[model samples]
Target chain A: MSVENSDLLKTPLYSLHESLGGKMVPFAGYLMPVQYPLGVMGEHNHTREKAGLFDVSHMGQVVISGENADQWLETLVPGNIIDLKQNRIRYTMFTDDNGGILDDLMITRRENDIFMVVNAGCKAEDIAHMRATMPDHLELTELNDRALVALQGPLAAEVLARFTSGADEMDFMSYGEVEICGAKCFISRCGYTGEDGHEISILAANAEEVCNALLGEPEVEAIGLGARDSLRLEAGLCLYGHDITTKTSPIEGALQWSIGKRRREQGGFPGADKILGQLASGDIARKRVGILPAGRAPAREGTEILDAGDNVIGVITSGGFGPTFGAPIAMGYVDLKYSAAETPIFLQVRKKKLEAKVANMPFVAQNYYRKPK
Target chain B: MTTYYSEDHEWINVESGVGTVGITDYAQNALGDIVFVEVPEVGDELAKGDEVAVVESVKAASEIYSPVTGEITAVNEDLEDNASLVNSSAGGDGWFFKISISDDSELEGLMDADGYKTFTAGLE
Candidate 1:
């Protein structure tokens, strides 16, 4: 599956990553930085303790507007787009008619439009899906002139405050329009690294300047996709192709919480039948659960899960060494009966059945900023 | 003792008939952080190119191949407790295992220090 270099796309910050000694690799049809000189372990640790900067420019940024935009969005997704308060973000997935997830994404209801950040690999298909099903009144526009970046960790807010106004005041999932280096930017108090952080979307032309300013901060270090992946895994977040796929349902993926109560009952979204059916019956055959391998061996994805009796129960979807937890952690689908915390299980790695246990997620505790009511 | 390198980025330092084996600095840097290592049992006989150990980083795993046909003499117990030793001292204390070389002629096929340096240069 090696893609030709000429065929691969480059993000606006591609050269910057190279200049910083980033290891470039092909990802989702784009040449991306997999890691930097700091290495995955160093970068992952830096992001948890201090602020780490990331280039998420490859993700799809889109805006949907026109008459009944919010309601129309609900028809496609399970999230309650109509009731979403302005400047608030919601995590949701695009599901197929069979209740399988097409892609997971973030949606923010803006003053006059709904802004979305879809997975890079799924963005084109998602847009085509919407365009095919959308009514004439709704207008969907994919933003090609912008770049997205994430500043994550305990010190993120402090670093972001110096460049953007009022960012320190925003709560988790709050969105605001701010200026950085005189570039109009959309800043959101959210991220995937299980840390209190913010993701800023700015013009592609100003990306380098804004990034240089943020990286200039003493607390911020340049992070690559390597750390981004491990951080998200430790945070118990899903990676699109690895953790959740078109064959997995939102319920089985442990993302039922992403659906809103109104959407759950009103049931206008795709996969409503099977999704609501599983919700009502609570008889899902399999559920995504966290697995803690008993030893040092990391049970990678596709490692089969076995019960105490040696019965093949399920398979691992995402597995890696969690730098913060200092152990091998994984998330996988298992028979609902074996999804309980502390349930003894085995992982088939290299023909050996390694002992493991079903554990709760977020191996590293999340630190999202929340305001007191 | 003399050190020899393999195209697989592993180094085997031979002292008499026994050899101490570990990955090179380039392999460690390419592999990122070393989190876990699976070493072969002492008494196992392996052929040249046979997998001797499995080194795992946070992201993925790589297999360390035997440079020459040999019988495993001893394993690196330090790696079981502190795999990061592979990253900290890949050439010294971080050695993976010791193998009693069965065929001295196989050593001629492996790369010497200077040749290995040139081979690694071409990779970049």
Candidate 2:
């Protein structure tokens, strides 16, 4: 379906994307590129072997500062914030009073302030949640003028090192402020694609320049949201609205690893009573599982999953062809008994019941760079 | 043999009361890198505009409709192992099925080569 261009918002790199042959589509209230001329398959493969740049300027970037910023922030999120050393990033979710996920985000702690990267669709609510909850002395500032772009893949470090100092030396989930193409940029050694990469946040005016410089590199190609979604799917990462929502707590999403021990025990964050209780009992009703279709038909989202006896047990949340795996893969929530790897499940796709099995995720291996302990 | 095109981007090349069906290049281009295709079973009856087959690309799934009323005579087995054939040769080796034409008059409703070209041009 075509939308009138005038009704949608455009990023600062809209002109550059158009010049590069990007197929623009509506995503999260913005006209974003879904794929370039290289197409989704080529872009997914290139990002694994080389580097692909993506315009993620639609995500909301915010900074929370003032006295006890870390302590104050801890009250709203499940991940331990006070203990996170400067320049380290932690994946956390803001939960409601009932332990339901409000939104999932990445919080990067600086020397005195904390920077957050939130999902584009949930940003407005996330920002409002912080503004409404944080202590009176704290300051919540939205960096609306910044454009976020991700340089992802095995060759990402090699491509980024040329433009920014100390990029090659950064560890996974580490953050730093550096200059890229003469623009002051916030660089994070992190990405949604399972490959080793960096996310660069730049000023609106300098987004085109930085992106142009990266695309000039022989190893770097412009990747659109199509590859981004498939890459992250194969990487076993959850998309906020699809895989997790306010109705889904972290434990049910198999994201319990993101919640730290201190928070799990102390119970100060929102919905801590329920989240901590779930942690203690380990009785989650349904859990997310990786699924592989036995046949060639792709079992996409909203397809009902049935058990051995043809009784409906779950539904697919994210489903599609895993371009890298060369097979169709999906993630969905299933009853506790059917969530185990290798458990047989049937996907009711259209009129036929296609055979599928629960399997281990990260259909592609993760390649994040970490410091050897 | 006369080839007719449907608005859904399916082309049926009819010969000797049998029609070979496949998606057009424009359909494949819009779909992008087909990875899976579900072809109708041989001997199944189809009506004009019925959803006869499915072509799944890396990006999304598209339905290939029956351009004319007919009975499925044979299906393409190559698509089971190499769905990319739909992307490489959408109109030739990538054909989805063969149908025994039940109504020659139904073919009159489809567009010829020149007409199909004009029809697609107006979309852009």
Candidate 3:
């Protein structure tokens, strides 16, 4: 696409990124900053050690308005929307008739509406699905003109708190509207890097101003899709296309917890019966687990996982050398028998068989902030 | 003294019977930041164009091929700890290995400095 056409779909801070020497790349149909002059590793380490500012504007933001929006949305998702308090967010999924995952999303309840953020690549399809099933009274408004920025790391809270008062008071998964740089915006204490951070929603017009304000801070550095992928992988978060797809179910992906206990028993949502049956009878043949490569060689996606006798069991979904761990890590699905922590496995990297072991999720410790009651 | 370039972008500076090898500046720039370098073991025999080492960037991993048939005499151990040196001095101190040439005539098949410059110009 032409630059203007791409910028037409640009998030709020496109110009700001270009001004800072960011190399733009087409991602999810929107032009996004992939890295800055300092490069990906610099940004990756900066986020792990301090804070990394990311313009995740490509993700679709939508507001589900009208009465009973929560009740109507609950019918389509497996989360318990009725029990979800105001300003609280929950990670959820939409299922197909066969219990396969259609999309994974985040749902937040407001006083009079429900807000959601879905994957950029799957936004159009997800909105269409929701609109078809939603009650007539509910209005689905896609906030295409809004920009989303994610400030992730241990110091994210401290850095963002400077702009938004009472930011520290907001606990994990809680969100509220606040004024940042004299512009009103929505701030949520949530992130994908297993760190204590915030995702800010602002008007596209004010995106550059707000980004510049954040970048002015010494602790905050611009991060791109390259480090974003690696950080999320190290955090054990699944990428939509690679880790979870239309054919994958929450149960097989180790995301059963996303389906609330009440919803599990009621079985009203799509593929409810199939998913619930797997939960109860444990019929899933394979499960997703973390893989730590024995050496420096990274076994990338599509690499085959082999057993002792070189029997192919599963394939890697995402694999790379984790900058923080200083070693190669991956996530893949293997037969239940070989999915246990510390189970020996081998990844076929080219003509070589690299040793690996099934390990626990979040190869690094998660740094989320939870408030004590 | 003479210099040669491999198709895979490695350059070798030969003096006496030994050759010092490293990736070219163009290769390092194209690869972006170097995070890890897997060096071949010293004393390993390699044929021309054999995959002897690996260089990993943040986005992808690539194999470094041998420029000429030779027995590896030494390797740059500093790269194992500070791989970024390749990005800073790709054609100088970042040299990967030194090999005792098995056949001096193999250099005839490689590109000279000017030829390499012309070759990389076409790539851009």
Q: What is the TM-score of each candidate against the true structure?
A: 0.98, 0.98, 0.90
Q: Which lDDT tens digits does candidate 1 get at residues B1-124? A: 8999999999999998999999999999899899999999999999999977899999898988899998999999989989999999999999999999999999999999999999999999
Q: Write the per-residue lDDT of candidate 2 for residues A262-370, one digit (tens) a residue.
A: 8877889988888888888988899988999998888998899998789999999999999889899999999988999999999999889999999999899999987
Quote model 1's iRMS.
0.6
Worst 10 residues of 3 chain B by lDDT: B29-38
Instruction: Give the DockQ of candidate 1.
Output: 0.90
lDDT: the better of candidates 2 and 3: 2
Query: Which 10 successive residues of model 1 chain A have the least lDDT summed?
Result: A162-171
User: Which candidate leads the pack in DockQ?
Assistant: 1
Give lDDT for model 2: 0.92
- How far is B116's C-alpha from truth in model 1 (Å)? 0.3
For every prediction, compared with the true complex, DockQ reads 0.90, 0.85, 0.44
Distance from true location, Cα of B4 in model 3, Å: 3.3
Q: Is candidate 1 or candidate 3 better by DockQ?
A: 1
Interface C-alpha RMSD after superposing true interface residues, each candidate, one decimal: 0.6, 0.7, 1.7
When summed lDDT is taken over every stretch of 10 residues in candidate 1 chain B, the lowest stretch is B58-67
